[model samples]
Target: LEKKIAHQDAIERNAIEGKFGEGKRKYGLGRISARLQTTSETVIALQFLVMNLEKVLRDTFLSFFQIWKALYLFVNRKKYTLIIEK
Candidate 1:
């Protein structure tokens, strides 16, 4: 049980760390050059917000594409069956 819990914790930690690493590398989270504390906090918050929005957009697009592909294949399958019978 202890080993299973440790493994689960490591998996969660890796995912969290990967998100932070992605933010630092892509969203400018690592380079907050603000003068005031509030300004710095605001910058960090905005970066995280942007990251979350991007994730949502990406997931939405992926779901849309999958649905579209399935529909396309379903329609095409009927057409192919008709052609094969004729």
Candidate 2:
């Protein structure tokens, strides 16, 4: 097919720039896998934590996210800080 040939041509060109490695330079598998590797993730703002609560409590929400990212966010509901990872 025209499209498949064009895609193969593009992959061959991209693989040269990708310069994978002697072992990784698998032409057919490399080209096909590269096409399949374009997966993605989506994150919804979900809601702004600040907008729902009183001004005095804004600090708490900011504190939660900072601390959560620190822990890689294991708990869905976390209250009190525990320095799980540093």
Number of clashes recorded per candidate: 0, 0
lDDT tens readout by residue for model 2, 59-82:
788898898797774563366556
**Positional deviation of residue 42's Cα in model 2 after best superposition, in angstroms:** 46
**Most lDDT-accurate candidate:** 1
TM per prediction: 0.73, 0.22
Q: What TM-score does prediction 2 earn?
A: 0.22
lDDT of 1 by residue, 1-86 (tens): 99999999999999999999999999988898999999999999999999999999999999999999999999889665644453
In candidate 2, position 22 carries an lDDT of 26
- Please state the error at residue 7 of candidate 2 in Å: 70
What residue runs in model 1 are displaced by over 4 Å at the alpha carbon?
1-12, 82-86
Worst window of 10 by summed lDDT in candidate 1: 77-86
Query: What do the candidate models score in CA lDDT, each in turn?
Result: 0.93, 0.49
